[model samples]
Each structure stands twice: as C-alpha cells, then as structure tokens.
Target chain A: MTSQGVWTPEVVADLLLTAESSRTPVGSVTGRWPDFDLAAAYRTQDVGMKRRTARGERVVGVKLGLTSPAKQRQMQVDTPSVAWLTDAMELPPATVVPRSRLIHPRAEPEIVFVLGEELAGPGVTAARAMHAVSAVLGGIEIIDSRYSGFRFTLPDVIADNNSSSRYVTGSVQVNPDGFDLALEGCLLEVDGQVVDSATGAAVLGNPAHALAFAANQLAERGHALQPGWVVLTGGLTEAVPLAPGSHIAAHFSHLGSVVIKAD
Target chain B: MPTGLAGQHDSRTAVLNAEAAERLLAAYAGGEPAEPVIERHPAADVSDAYAIQRAQVVRWIAAGDQVAGYKVGLTSRAMQLQSNVDQPDYGHLMRSMFAPEHVPIPATMFIQPRVEPEVAFVLSRPLRGPGVTIADAVCAIDCLLPALEIIDSRIRDWRITIVDTIADNASSGAVVLGGRPVSPRAIDLRLAGCVLYRNGEIAATGVGGAVLGSPLNSLTWLANTLGPLGVTLEAGHVVLTGSMTRATPVAPGDRVSASFAGLGSVSVQFAPEQQEAAR
Candidate 1:
C-alpha cells in the first residue's frame, strides 16, 4: 500500500484499473488521499480512461449518476455527476450478464440520448441541448462498485467512474420531436415481478435537462459531446441489486423497453 | 304560452348552430363588432366555445392564413380576476398575427384593441402534451423574446364572458416580437422583469413569475392541454405566454413599447385610421 496522501493520479488510476481487471474489491481511497475532491477524482478517472484507450477501448459516450432528486438526496449530494462509457462496456440486449466478472452488481433504468450533432457548452439549456439529439431510447445500466460493501463518498465514486460496468440499450429508437419526455413512464421488473417504476421526469424533472447538465459538466473538462455518442441520462428509480439467474426488464412508455439476464 | 316557449327553444338552437358561429367569425374578420355569443346562446359550454373557435380557425386556414402557433390567456391571477374567470383560456395565432417591430399598425384592422406586454417562446422541436413539465418545455424552446400582444374584442361594447371570449378565439388580434433573441439558459426567467411604456411613459411593470409562477409553466400547461386534442406545438412555432399585467387599451396614434430586462424592447404605433387607405 502507498503512504497516505502520497498517491499520485497515476497511482490511483492504476489501483482502480487493477481492481476492475482482477475482479477484486479495494479499500476506500478517500481517507488516505489528502484533499481528494471531485476535480482530483476526475483527473484519476481521465488517467484510467486514457489507459483504456491505449488498450484498444474506444469511448462511446457518458453516463450520468444521481440526476434524480431522490437519488441525490439518498446519496447526500446536491448535484448530478458523470462517468465514462466505452465500446467495451456494451452488453447486447437480453444477453446474460457476466456475473463472475462483477462484484455486487446492480441495475438501473435510464433514458438514452443519441446525439445528432456536436454539443459543447459552458452554458447549455434544456432546449438548446435537445437540438443535437437524433433519437431517444430506453436503457439499463449495470453498475458494479469495486469498493467493498458498495461504500464510498462522492469523490470515491467519481474515481471509480460512478460504478459503471456495462449497459444494454433497447432496440426501439424514437424521434424525440414532440414526445413528452417528462411524462414518459417506465416500469422495471425482476423475475417477472415489478420492482420499480417511474417517469422520465424523475431524471432531473426532464431527461433533456439531465442531458443539458451532462453537457455543461463535460464543458468543464474542455470536452464536447460528439455526434453518434449515446448519453444515458441516469437512473429514474432506485437501483436494485442483481442476483445470479435473475432477469430484468425495463419498459419505457413511447420509447419501448430493454431486458437483461444475469448469470 | 306553450307556442311562445317552443319558439324560444327554436331560436336558441339556431343561435348555437354552425351558421351563427360563421356569421360571428365573419363579423370578426371584417373588423366589425357584433353581439356577444353568450347573450345569444346563454347555455353554451366551454366545449361549444372551443367548437366555435375551431370553426373560425378552419375558415381562416381555408382563406390562406397559416397557423403560426397558439397562445395562453388569462394566466395571471390579476387577469383571471379582472376577467371574472377562474380558469385560463387559449387561442390560435395566425401568420397575419405577427407584426414587424417598430412598425405602425393599422388602427382600422381592429374594433377595440388593447396592448399587453408578454414573454414569447420560439420552439426548436415539436412538443405534445398530456404530461409536459417545466423542464420539458424549457428543453423544447429555442429562445425567448419580449413581445406585445394586441388583443381585440370582436364583441360589441367589450361586454364579454368566458364563452364569448373563447368563441372569439380568446380575443387574439396581433403580436409584435422584440428584435433580441436570448437563450433561455442565460437568465433566471422567473425573475425576469419588464416595463411597459405608453407614449414613452411608464404604464406598468411586472415580472415573469406573474404568469402562473413562470412562463415555462404556462407553456407546460399548453402542451398538456393541447396534446389530447390532436394538436402539436411544432418546431419554429412561436408561443405567446399570457400577459404579465392588466392590458392597456390602445387608440389611434398611440405608441406603446415594452422593454424587458434582458430580452430588449418591442414597440408598435397604432396608425391613424386615415392612413389605412394609403397602405
């Protein structure tokens, strides 16, 4: 173990990458790192993302976390946060999740925004942000926290890339034009039983607003959301822990549905 | 006595028919005031009022006037109280309703005209509702602008009821949009302020929160209300949210301007009736 408050961004990034690849849980770095804030966590994440890029993994887009007020309150955070997604993290819809490779995995329902144009913003608005969207769809995120007991502070989670493991997008693609996304209702089921249900409004009162928040946040890092990128707006309901041989399905009103099986 | 009672019922039915609605709309299009529809048909409900308004809009569209967008009226508590109606009303906006900023408007085009300062939304994407929210509305908007809605009452003597106004397409007349287009993100719209000027003097001042808490809420209400009716607020459509203050009447030669804190200003002059012939 490294000395307290002495770990560099490279050291932190390597530790996280090693934990993920070896399917092992790691101790929380929050107490050990001096002045470890969101900015520092993002720097560690950037280093890890760069390493992934060097390993033949291409970034697809981003995933938002704690966008819903309830989720924010549950996490004791006031603002939404983000994580990176890559092509290697995609799981085909209805495909069984690789349970052995994940530790204490959970699933969440999300509204996906597929960009049609580049979206950059220091000042992004819900309306202006939506102009770049090509389509909307339903999605499910499989989050596997590398921290023991799924415990961590906001900075700790940020350094872990918001616990992102894999994602599955629905087949149905709908033009977002004229669709009342706020009112888009969703139902999440496990083992053919309803576990959670919510509307798109639950994601920051509107999924587009969540997308706008993501764009503004990305702009802080001198990055822009590029076309063909898929953004998961965040979980609309409380995430449920995944179990072996359990099947999950999320039904989104107007946008259709997505399913995942864990084995 | 029985014969007289039957005659009254026949007259009521005729007054509620499509022909009566068309005749009333014709008077409106001709800029001629007529008897209030409620006086003619005392039992006309809100749905009947909407039917009459729809009939007039169909005729306007047939006459080559494109549907520009829609508007929400009586959203302010003051307007609702002044109008003596508890609920808000809506109307259709025609392409002709748009007037150039800083231009003179023909006084002969309306019988009894009034001006109200308003906030306008330009949509970048289509919005349909039964469940639209403030966030959804904000995302659908492209920009915001200062506006003035010139409302005209087609009913003679300005004696109108909810049904009468509704049948008159919520008394929609014309709109003057400001030159400046501001992105919705730059300002806290609920706190946006405006000052109305008549002849370069302050007439009234109000904030965006006056319109049902915020203008975005008004748009949300419109989307949800129009969604089930098979109407969609399309991209590029301009929506006039209800006025922020009580409307002020305008006469020939009157110059009215309204300046918004961040949206700039829009002005219009009611040209003398004699100038109508020259144009």
Candidate 2:
C-alpha cells in the first residue's frame, strides 16, 4: 500500500502493467488518487502504451467501451470511453485461447471499421464517417479486467485500457457502401448453443455513429483515425464468460462469422 | 476613344471589352504573370477584379478541378496596413489546393511562393450573407483547424496592388489543414495563439484576434459578402479566415510548421525542383 497522493501516471502505469503480466488482479486505484480526472487517466493509458511499445508491441488502433446504453448502465457510467489496442492483442482465427495469459477472460461481439482515409472530428457525422471506412468486419474481443472482481470506476477502467486483452477478426470483409449497417445482426454462440444476439444498432443506435463518436473523442485529445487503422465499435451484448475447452463463435448478417476455441 | 470617355461606351462594346479582359487574364494565368491589370486599366475596381476571378474559376473548373470553398485575405489590420488595402478580399479554393500535411510540395509548380498561418472553419451547415451574424456563423461551423496557406503571386516579383491580387485569385495557392478538429465553442477564438516555425526555428507568433478582430468575424464577413452574389458557404466547405502572421518565404528543402494553442499544429515541406524534361 502506497500513500494516496504518491501515485503519478508513471507509477500507476507500472502497477497496472505488473498486474497484467502476472495475471493477478489488483485493488482499484480510484480511491488511492484524489480527483483522478479523465486527463490523468488518459495520461496513465499513454504511459502504459509507451511501456507496451518498449516491449515490442505496436499499436494497431483503438476500441470504444460502454457505448451501448445497457453497457453504460451496467458500468454505471453515462458516457463511453476509449482505449488503445496493440498488434499483440490479435489472435489467429480458430486458435485455442491462451488461458494461461489472461485472468478470467470474457468475450463480446463487435463490429470493426477499417478506415480508408484519415478522419478528424469535432463535427463528424454518421454519413461522413462512412466515407472514411474501407471495410466492415465481424470481430470478437476477449476482455480481461486487471482489477479484482472485474469491478472498477470509469477512470480505473480507462487506466486499464478498457480491460482489453485479445481480439480475433472475421475473415470476410464487406464494403460499407450502401450496406444497411443498422440492420446488420450478429448471433453469439458458445459451445454450439446460441446465447445472445444483437444488431449493429445496439451500439449507440448505429455502429457508424460509434465511429463518429470515436473520431470526435480522439479530436479532443489532438488525435485522429488514420488510414488502415482498425476501429472497434463497442460490444453489442453482455460479455459471456469464457471457460476452457469452450468454442465461441459470432455470426454476422453480412460479414462472415468468426470462431475461437478456448483451451 | 479617349480613356476618360470609355465609361460611356454602349452595352455591346462593354460586353466585348469584358470578354477581352477575361481572355487576357486567362492567358496570364496559364502562362506567367505580367503587368498588373489595374496598371493598364485604371477603372478596374474590386468588383471588376472579382469578375475576372470568376472567369479564372471557370477555367479551373474546365480543367477538372472542383471548387472546395473560399478564403478571405487582407482581413487583419496589420495585413491591410502592410498591403495598403482598406478592405478585405476573397478568393476561391479548388480541391487541388488542399495538400496533405508532412507531404513535400513541388516548388516548380509555384512562382515566388510564401506561407502564412491561418485558422480554418469547416462548415456543417449552409450559411448565406446579408443578415448573417457571428452567432449564425458559429452555429453553422462544424470545427476549427490549424492551417498553413501557401500564397504564390503570379504577378512578377509580387509587385501588385489590391486590385492586382484580387484579380489573381487573391494570390491563393495551397492549404494544409491540421489533423485535429476542435469545436468552435471549445475555445475563445480571440485568445487562441499560434507559433510558426520555419526550418525548425520560430519565425513568427500571432493570436487569433489578429484576423479582423476574430476568426469568427472574418467568417461572418465572408458569409455576408457572398450573400448578394447568390453564393452560400456550403456545408463541408473549409473556409480559411486570413492569416495571423505575415507571409514567410520558403526555399526548396525548407520545412514550415505552425502550432496553434488549442487546435494542434500543421506542417509542410518544399521539395527541390525536378529536372526539366527534355522536349
């Protein structure tokens, strides 16, 4: 236990990375720091990214969390938050899950946007957001909170990079043009049994709106989505707990399905 | 045939004279800048300059370039004082004029190119002039971006008056917009500041208020000025509202960057001229 006011961004990032590598959950840092604002959280995330890059992990793009109303309510937060994703987070399709690495991992289905051009925002609309997208694909994110009991505050989650651990993308890529994304549905199945299903509209009414929101959010921090960057729009349904030897798959209406074997 | 009596010419003769002036201006634009048109025709005013600009715009359109938006120049009191112009001027921006940041621009395409730091407004809604106010302008704006406008004079040695510049499309050349887009309501335009760097050294510094009191004021002026011409500042158009700092000349291999206080920074580099191809 350290002094409440002694946790700088570097110290906090170090503590989180230690917890992540050891696969051991730590107590929430929210109460330890006084007035830990969003800026401080983002700074901590930046430090964590530097630490990751130093370890030879390259940033692929970003992810949005707590975008859906249900997810926001579940997290007790009114607004959504962003997190960075590194290339190391990607898992090969149909590969067995690395259970030894993650702590109590959970899976959620997501829609991913592959950008064709750079997009900056403050006033990015859904219609204009589509023009920047090159393709849409189905994806599954494996979330593993570094905090004990998977319970944390907004700042805590942000500092943990939104509990991002691993991801697997679908093989099929569909062009976004003229595609009715709002009506695009996904079925989440576990061990060959349908557990949950949702539409693209489950993510902030539409997934494109999520992308626009991401652009506007990044603009607040003097950043923008670049060409070839993959953006993960938030999860569609409640994350299902992953157990060893279980098979998880998500089938999309337009985009093809993605399957992962947990071992 | 007397110079003073030329104003009393018949409507047919006036039309023919305008056509001839357009032809002369187009020829100059396609080739090299020669003597100022105002020096040859003392009767030419700002309106006549704009008419000539319209003819140049038609030529650009015919060349397969689309009109992106407009830019306001000579808006700052310092610029007006330096250029000896009492009022602001406007120019058209073609899609080709927009350059990506960090990209090296070819120097051979320009004549005596100079750069200035500016604040750009990206419109989200259409705004027309006459009754347009600052509030209307603000509401219509989607975001503000830091930008560097490359102004190149076609006129020889840039020795031209207000009429000459306006006729030469307000000496417009290229623009590089910053990656970050800030909401107009996020920061006070009057208080925003910028530091311009040339070749990695600070060349100039300025605040947003330097542009016609504020960039919002410049935008309002633009909306109102275009109203009577039946032109509206369309949605998604990027409007550059004059420069905060004086124009700085750049040589090949020189890199220029401007960092705005709230709206991030934008940079551009000039590449060495390519070897002339043999005929």
Candidate 3:
C-alpha cells in the first residue's frame, strides 16, 4: 500500500526480514501480492540479500532449490532456482544451534561443491560446471521457512531465499572428476532409525547438473559462482524436522558421515 | 524457565530441556522408559515441560506425521490431587496415535500401557480465544465420539510429577475412537455412565461428571488454554476430553472395552506376548 497500493520489492523484503529476525511465522508473500511473478521474486530476493550485506553479512555461497523433479511438480514449477547464502547462516564445527532463536527447522542432506575458479554462464553445461569445482563436500541444510506451515508458492519461496536458515558441511572433500555422483547414495537417520534414503541423482539426476543449473540461473540475475564459494545442490530426500534432543545423521557413499545433535 | 547457560539448580536450563527431550525420545525409540525427567531437572516447571513436549511435536511433524488433535489430562479433582496438581494439562494428539479398533495392539507399542475411557469432542467449528466458554464449546462441538485412550509413560514406573507427565505428552501412547457419533446437544454428557470391561468382566465404572464437572467444561478449558499459544481448536479436529475413570494397567493378551450409556462403545485388544517384542 505504500506505493500504488502494490507491494514493492523493498516493502516485501522489509516484511520478510522482520519475520526472519523476529522468528515469527507469517503467511506467504504471494498471498499479499497475487500478481507477483518469478522475475519480481528474484528482485525481492536480491533486495533482501542487499539488506543482509548492509548488516555486515557477506555472501558465502549459492544454493539451489526445487532441484528434485518431485519437488518441482509439487511446487508447480518446471525448473530449479538459486539463492544466496551468507556467512551468518553457517553452523560451524562443534557449535550448538541456538534453538530459541529459530522457528521450527528441518534438516535436508545436500551435495556441496567448492569452487576452484570463478564461472559465469547462461549456457553452462554439466561438464563445464564440473570444471570449476575444486572439491565436493557433504552438507546438511537446516531450512526454517518464515511462511506458516512451510506453505509457499514458487515466487513466495524464492523471495524468502527458499527457506534457507543454517547449514553445516562435512570434512571429506573429493575431486569430482572420477566420482560416480549419479550413483552417490545417502542415508538419513534419526534416533538410530533409517528414516529416508536417496541418491545424488535425486537432485536433477547428478548434482553437477544442479550446479550447472545454478550457474545459468545466476547468470540471468547478474551473478556468478566465485572461487572458494561453495554450492549446495538441492535436497536428496525430504527434510526431516529438527527438535531439541533429536539426533540426526547423514551417511554418504563417498563423502564422510555427519552427525548433529539438536541443542 | 531458562536459567541462562550457567549451571543453576534454581531453574530448568535450555540445554537441560533439550537433553531431557533427547532422553524421552531415546526411551521412545529404545522401548525402555527412563527415570523421571523431573529428578534430573528438579526446577523444571509446567512451562518447561510444555517446551519439551513441543520439541517432540516438531520432530514428529517433520517425520511426515500430522497432529490430529489435542487431549486434556488430569481433569478429575481426585486424580489431580493424586498427582499433586490443581490444574489439568494438555498434549498434542498425532494422527499416528490412533490405533485400529478390533485389531490387537502390539506388545511393543508401549512400555507398560494403561487404559482409560473418555468422551471425545469433535469440533464442527473452530474454537479459539482467551474467553472461550462452555457455551462456546457447545456450539463448536460437532459430535461426541466414544474413545479409549491407552496411556503410557516414558518415565519409569510412572513415578511422574505434573511436569514429568506434561513433558511426556501427558503420558499419551495411543487412542482408539469407535462407535456412533452423538450430537453435542443430543446427550447430557455429565450423567453419561461408563462401564469398562477387561477380560469380559467389569473392571471400572464412572460417570462423565468426573471430568471437570462435565465433558463440555473440559473442552472449554482446552480451548481457553490453547488460545494464548496461538493455536486454535480447528474445525474437524478431534479433542479427547479428560478420562472419565481411573487408568487401569493392561498387559499383552488383554481385551478391554468401555460402553457409555446412550452414547457408544470403544475397545482394544493387546496382542499376545511374543519373543520378537523384546526388541
């Protein structure tokens, strides 16, 4: 209502930032602006990123969302999208998460890529995407959506940075050249029970493709994958909820296993 | 309830809450109940216990389970006194908590299970507010359903304080709702008498008046209590009113049933003991 009775990118970004900062769950952004499209959503996301940068948070990496064909169909979107990750979102080694500061969060396993060289492209192929990689690491993405019930449309989620909150990376880093990433397997366990399992192919059938997808998506948005920047491929399985006292672990075929205690 | 990060015996610390929740979830997974959580966090209040309960609810919902409703516990004055509590507590009822009727519940489902009969409230209209009254509960109540709540404790030997039981989801194990749905206004629930039969013989009998004077009052209490927490007794949500009788212990191969006058009946049969159940 501030500008022509429509939600400007600034207004939407401010609303979202407030929601995230206060850990308050609000309705989806699309609910307020019914006509917002994918392009405008990216603008709002950029606006939110700028706000973070102004607050002393630097962009650390890039991540993809809806890379799973199943998730794509569920979100009614044909392709995956990219979002920025800041240093403020990292959960360092042996650090306990501040549970009271976060709303309900869920953990999803991801394939992470560390870049050796900067790359920008609108037509980045999977092979070209792999050429920039220095090493690949295992990661657990902690997603806590600001939207109530995690219900959001494509544009709604994009503007919210795809519910990105916190993430932790594993130690074992392997070169991608000889890796059988398409067949890479992951087991998500909670309380010693194997709850869900998936292969790297679950994310666009080889996470390299997802990396390439992120590059092209970023090119259109005037950004590039930079050297030393990590790229998190989308979730391989449905994210499991994180609660105080829950013990969750992810076992990867090539990358080392990671365990996190919700505290 | 947070005593900061310092080791203080005056209150329940946040770390201890998480650790306590881990203990409960571990016992749930291992099928071996642990000692009472209150003993470890002696200063943990009802609010801290609620915080622990909510943490588990977050875990269950993430595991692809949906919360079907809420349950009111310790509504009877006598039962409240026995538990040394002046007020009742509520817990989240998950969809997975509904055990199938007529089928034998596995011996491994709970650690030392007990049975209690209740008159469940099915809301046709959502109930929310700081001022929800019995009349409001009456209007929103769609129907009364016969229900049998199988109570189980994650705390060993059921040595539970009010906080202990609250943190353990009011000792909720599973629920079985059966028989016909009675209209809210069609029956006077306070006078509804129930005869619970275990092994085909009378084991317990009680009237709905035992539940906070009337079952409707219990419904009112739940709605009013949950309002400040930003939760609503949603339409189509099932609310299990407080138990009408004392909880009776049940072991493997036990057949339990309760029939309410002018309402309906519900029952459950625990499966016979098996060697594999030891796991």
Candidate 4:
C-alpha cells in the first residue's frame, strides 16, 4: 500500500502555507515537484484559501494577476490567474504597513469594484457585467513574492496565490456611471514623486472586460461573485518598491486617491 | 449548495428598486430617517438609486408638490471623504424646501441636519444641453446669491453609501438664499471667497473654485448631465452650486451665516423646540 504523495494539491498547499506563515522565501516548484500542473495549481490555491477560511478569515473578494498583456508576456502566460482575498489581508485606512513582517513587497495601483449584485458567467460581456457594479474605488495592492527573487512560473504563482500580502482601498467610492472607466488614469507616487502612471486601458483593454473574465472564470469553478464583494481588477502600472517612512500614494482621475506609508 | 442563477436579473432588479423606494418614501413622509437602505437592498446600484429617486418625484408631483430647482452635493475633496462618495450627485429642490432668509427654521423639519455654504444660481432662461459649455451656463443665470443648504440624512446616523444618499434625494433638506444679488460677470466667481460662521465663531473658509473648479463648471455639468435625460434647467429655477466647504452640524437655537467676498452675506437660525414651522 502506497501511503505517500509528494506533489498532491493538499501537500503543496501545506508547504506553501508553512513558508508563507514564516515569512520565508523559497525557490520555484518547477521540476522540483512531480505531477505539478496548472489544474493542480488551482486546486492548491483553493485548498489554501479553504484553510484560511477555516481559521476564521472571511473571503472579502478576489484579485486577478497577470491580467495585462505586458504582465502576461513577462510571466510567460497568456491567461490571468485568480486568487482569493481574506479579511485578514485588509489594511485599514491611514495605518502604516510594517515592512519588517514582509520579505520583500511591491505596491501596485488597481481599479477596484464593489459589486451591487451577483455576477455569474460563461457568456458574459463587459457591458452586461458592468450592470452588476455599484461603485468603484482606487486601490493599492501589496504583492509580496513568497518565492525567492520573485521568480516563479505560471503554475508556481497560481499555487502561491500570486503572492498577495495585503490591500488598502481609498475612502472615496464613486458610482461607475460618472466616468468612462477605460480612460480612467492613475499616478503611482513614492515619497511625493511620480514614479509610474497608467490608464485603465492598460489593464486588459478595459477593466470591465477583466471583470467579465473574472466572472466567467469563477463560473468555471462553480463559484460566482456576490454582492458587496470587492474585486481588484488587476495592477494597472508596474509596481514600485516600499521602504520605511516612504510616503506612497496613488491618485486616480476620478476615483479619488489612496495613500499608504511603510513603517 | 446552490444551483443555476441565470436569466433572472431583470425581475430581481425591479424588486430591489421597489423595495428601496418604499423605505425612503416612508422616511420622507414621516420626517424620520430609516436604516441604511444599502444593507437591505444589496443589488441597488447608482442607476437603480436614480430610478428610486425618479419614482418619488412622480409621487411628489402627483401630491400637488411643485418642482422648485436642483441642488448638487459632494463637490469638494473634503466633502467626498466626509460623505464617503467620490463623484457628485444632485437632487430636486421642491417649492416647500426653501426657507426664508434670516428666519429661524424648526428643528423637526430635518433629521440630523447640517449646513453648507453655496453660491446659488437662479436661472433667467431655460437652458437645454447635451454639450452645454461654461459660457452657456453663465448666460442662463439671472444672478448669483449667497446661500446655505441645510443637508439632512434620511439614513440613520448618516450611515450612507452612494445608493442610500441618492435614494434619499442627495441628502437635501432645506435651502436658505439671501444677500444682494450680483450679475454673473460682476466678479470673478472662481476666485470668490467666503467665510462661514456658526454662532458667532468662524466655522469654515473656502473659495468658489472648491466646487468643481468653479461653480460655473458645476452649472454646466448639471445642465449637460441632466439634458440627455430630458431634464432642463428651467427659467427662474434655483441651482445650488454645491458646498464650498465641509458641512457643519446644526442644532436647535444655533445661528449660522456665511459672508461672501463679493456676494454679500446670508444667515439662518434653528428655532428652539416649541412648535414645528408651518409646512
């Protein structure tokens, strides 16, 4: 009787969780773990999220990684990967994030949606998907790689939940009807200097399409986006580094601004 | 534990619209606020909120109420964070909503009322717009008057989301307009400044540019936003050009006033609890 499996989803999830909890970085899983594939990667993500939920962390929303073509090319992936966000990952407004708890963190500005209704799909269009959105807010995502040098393959990242660390949303939540979201602009600033800038179009042409894709992708897994859930579409511009006492801010064209400082 | 949930969005939307409108209407009639409607109407979006607002307008018109004007809300950055909404929204000002200048208003007329200083635009001619310009809006104006908007919430403790405030008529309660009316071109409206005082103490200071780069732009935005929907800024209609500073709280017997640099000054008082003002 064989009682051992080295590359099972549960085992991979356990190893990833252990490394994540200790704030330690590990190498890529490619060629190291046998039977490691994309489907198994997704299963590992699901199992990891389940363990988090079991520990009393509520799933607040979902986040998309590698949504942009440039990001996909850099990661050598054609499709984006999805990850779950828990309440424990939320950073309250005006609170400084302590960098000592993180191995290395980079910040990206995002277009976030707070859904007003359930969005389920497989054949959903961006126009139809927007009907479910209530408000849009500027968001900052802290993406930390649990893998060394932030180097990982597609399956490696999907299993690691795209290295999500924490997120903070702006105080302002505006109705999406107020502006053309595709042209929505954002400026990523560090220490009061503009470091990066990108429009909403950078995120998969339009963020709404990414949202539609998210809904369709969730449907594939027998899940759906529910009301009041916050969806982080994806990072719009290249991420910038975080250091102690750095004044970081993302100013959006119409969605107001979100500012954070690293302590 | 769940099954298919497709093709039912339309019917589900209507139910949410009706339920949202009903609660807000009840709160309006009883002069008492309700719990935040967003919690109960999970599917209410901005469009759904506007639909609820329009439904109430219909009912109010049927009840012999006359449309007075329009009031814009959440114009400044500070106001955005205060109310937790990013973009601006507007509400209708019924004929019954205007309070006389320098008169004491009854406290019971509103629930958790706060005051805002504004530059009121009383239109001279009807303005229709899909692409209305700033000049067109300035040309339509008869005059600008110093004004105070008594903003009240129909959501308990002002725990409002965007849907909640829009459904409650942009958190509007009463308008107090006064001061010597000045021609639109008599002064640089963008640079116009004002000092708001509450009970003989300076409360807030701001300039006209605080409202969407100028109250003129806000006027054009209103005309353009509503014109596509078939709403016009009619002649003699008073357009409250949004708040210039953060809204300050008001209580019974409290006196509040605002002095504008070139537009003169206006004031209002909240009468002590004795009897409700004539409605």
Query: How does the DockQ of candidate 4 come out?
Result: 0.01
DockQ of each: 0.01, 0.01, 0.00, 0.01
TM-scores for every predicted model: 0.49, 0.49, 0.50, 0.51
| lDDT by residue for model 4 (B192-266), tens | 556667898656655576677678877888898899999999999999998876678999888999877678889
Model 2, B1-279: lDDT tens digits are 985566655454445436535754554467565666666666677777787778778877998999999999998765687778877899999999999987788765577789999999999999998999999999999999999999987777888788778878898989999889999988766645566678976555555666776789888999999999999999999999998766789887789998776678899988854532211
- Fnat per candidate: 0.00, 0.00, 0.00, 0.00
Error of 4 at B222 (Å): 0.5
DockQ (0 to 1) for model 2: 0.01
Spell out the clash pairs found in candidate 1: A126-B139, A127-B139
Clashing pairs in 3: none
Native contacts retained by model 2, as a fraction?
A: 0.00
**iRMS of each prediction:** 17.0, 24.2, 25.0, 16.0
Over the stretch B62-167, how does candidate 3's per-residue lDDT look in tens digits? 9999989999999876678888887889999999998889988886789989999899988898999789988888999888899999999999999998999999
Given the true complex, what DockQ would model 3 score?
A: 0.00
lDDT (C-alpha, whole model) for all candidates: 0.84, 0.82, 0.85, 0.83
Score residue A179 of candidate 4 by CA lDDT: 58
Question: By lDDT, highest first, what's the ranking?
Answer: 3, 1, 4, 2
Per-residue lDDT tens digits for candidate 1, residues B3-77, read 999999767665585754776777766877888887767778778888888888888899899998888998876
> For candidate 1, lDDT tens digit of each residue in A29-124?
886775788888999888888999999999999999988666677779988998899999999888899988888899998889999999998899
